[model samples]
Each structure stands twice: as structure tokens, then as C-alpha cells.
Target: MEEAPKTLAHQIGGIQNDALRFGLHGVKSDLVGSHPLDVAHRSTIKTHEDMKRKVLANTYGSAFPLKMDLDRQILTRFQRPPGPIPSSMLGLEALNGSLDDFGFEDYLNDPRESEVYRPQDMHHGMEVRLGISKGPVCPSFV
Candidate 1:
């Protein structure tokens, strides 16, 4: 109930600029999702549309018929960071067998993910690992 305004307030407010004003949307006086917006927007909703629907329903009331085309364009523009990032890491974990294991390795090489971790068949001019820790996070585990 708290989120309804935050998600679509801009769109709802935009109603003034356009023609059809749906009722006032719920302003995000508080969190109404699986997570908070700062963290949720990053960790939870992975895509623009996902964020849009989540916010819209939380903010205003309905997900149908956004206020205007510009709203949609803005919503669609945001995108998840490259898949190769998680894929590269998860791929290793998944391959390690059943321990910290889950997810598809193919996903790392998937077009959606960056090409840094290219398909086995593909060749790269260079291979550089970034932001990876050399030692285990948990000393005991290492």
C-alpha cells in the first residue's frame, strides 16, 4: 500500500501534461516490495520493465496504460548489467558440482551477457580477470 505513489508518481503527475489523469497514484511513502527501492531496484528487479511494473503497481494502482509514451521509453531504457559478470562467476561455481552450485554456464556466454566470457569455441585476444578475489571469502572454506 505504501509503494503505490513512488513507482508511478512521475507518470501520474505527468497526467497533468497529457490528457487522461488516472486517480492519484500511491506515493512511495514506504517500501511495499520484496525489498527496498535502492537495494530492490538493483538486486531485485533486473530489468527496466520489471522495475516499471513493480514501481507502477506500488506507486499508482494499475500497471495498464502508462501515462505517456515517454514514460515507456524511459522505463525501457534501463537495463541489467552484462550477464557475463554473474555468469562467469556462477559458471565456475556451477561447474564445481553440487556445493555453491546452481545456474547455467551457457548463460555466461549468452548474448545478453558480455562477450568477455565468450563461448568455448570463440577465441579472445586477451583474458583479464577483474574484481575477483584470489583467496576464498571465508578463511575456513579456503
Candidate 2:
């Protein structure tokens, strides 16, 4: 469980680094996937067509066309951080890398009952609900 956040941080850092690299090399946003302007134009045309069909009830009848916003989708899928990448660390400080005395065991059984939601409650709750004290040592269920 502790490794999950660290692994995610590593992956996110790699992606951020790649974006920085692409930005530094002058990768144009318009060139990514399809051109946004072109996609918007096509979407406008499709919307007009759908509107015409709905009004006339020629083929689809009164059913409205369920069309996705292609332009917005493309922009969202390829959005880069605006301006230059910051020299300072982004938001990695929230992870364990920044904490000096952060310990995982504290979450399981902490002295501050009001401050922390102990995992023992969840463990005992599940045991009570399932009518079992502790889980089996091996893969006995399978």
C-alpha cells in the first residue's frame, strides 16, 4: 500500500518530464492529434446536419443525435501545461517523500482517536459482518 503512492508519483513525474521535453522542442498544440479548428468545423457541420434531420424527421425521426464534442475531447486529451514548466517541484510534497516522521503503522492504531480513523475499525467491522475473526493464512477459499 505504501508503494502505491510512490509508484504513482514516479509515473506522474515521468509524464510531466515528457511534457516538458515536448514543450521545450516546440511541439505545437495544433499538430497534436487532429487540428482543433478543423475538428470544430467538422463538428459544426455535423451538428447542422443532425439538426436538419431532427427537424425534418427524415431518417432518425424525433430522436436527437447523441454526438460527442470532438474538439473539446481532443483538446482535453492533449492539453499541455500552459507556459514554461516551473523550476520548483510541482505538488510532490504531498506524498511521503516530504514527511519526516510519517509512518504507515500510525494509521492502523493511532493514539489520537479523534484525529485518525483507525483501520482496525474496518478490520473488525468486516470480521463481525462476515462472522469470521481473522482471514485464513493461505488460499483456503479457492
Candidate 3:
């Protein structure tokens, strides 16, 4: 019947409008959730340890012992070489100039050149090669 087709058209139009309304509402909900206030609220529940664990886990997986050992090796590699006070550190002017030439500024500026520069891909590949199973372990590793 003509009336039945008209009714179906109206119903379809109403459903389409409802879907558009729902989509717009979803965008609005996402906007509110991403607001600074909501972000701060979410961050407040996370502690320093949680952040550190996330960083370490992301960079080194769950291998804490290996990660710690690698960190120690990197640190030990950067220790200052043993030597006597050079002529550069003798006077105030010389001391200032020597301090300027100590390379700390360069080190701070270009961290990528640091001894501990571990690429994410390399770390993940190394972890896989080490036979560390991904995700939750079974009763065997336990």
C-alpha cells in the first residue's frame, strides 16, 4: 500500500536522524573526556612509580634484572677518566673556560648520543631473541 511505504520512509528517516544524533553525542563525549580537567583527573590516580614502571616496561619490557644491568653498564661507561688537575682548571678564568669545555652542555642537548640510547625496535627484538615470552606467563615460568 502507498500509506505503508510512506510510513516505512518516515521510520527510516527517524532512524537515520537518531543515528546522526548518536554520532554527534559520541563526538561531544570524546571531547569532554579529552579535556584538560579530565586528563588531570586521570593523571592524579597514577603515581611516580606507576609512571616509571610504564616507562621501563615500554623501553625494556618486564625484564627488570636485565634492564638494571644494562643501565649500570651504561653509567659505568660514562665515568670521568682519572687524571690530575689540568692547567685549564688552575685559575678562575681557566676554571670557567674548562667548565665550559666540559661537554656537559652538548651532553644535555643531544641525549641521543648518550651511552644508554636504546632504540625501541632493538630492545623489542633483543627481548624476543632472549626467549622471554610475551604477556602473562604460564605456571611453568612461575
Question: Quick one: best TM-score, which candidate?
Answer: 2
Best by lDDT: 3
Clashing pairs in 2: none
Per-model lDDT: 0.37, 0.39, 0.41
Worst 10 contiguous positions by lDDT, candidate 1? 120-129
TM-score of 2: 0.22
Tens-digit lDDT track for model 3 on 14-50?
2322432222223554455467887786787556547
Error of 1 at 118 (Å): 5.8
Ranking by TM-score: 2, 3, 1
How would you order the candidates by lDDT, starting with the best? 3, 2, 1
Q: Count clashing residue pairs in model 3.
A: 0
The clash count of every prediction, one per candidate, is 12, 0, 0
Which model, 1 or 2, shows the larger lDDT?
A: 2
Model 1 TM-score, all chains together: 0.15
Tens digits of per-residue lDDT for model 2 on 94-134? 22134454666457753333343222334333443354543
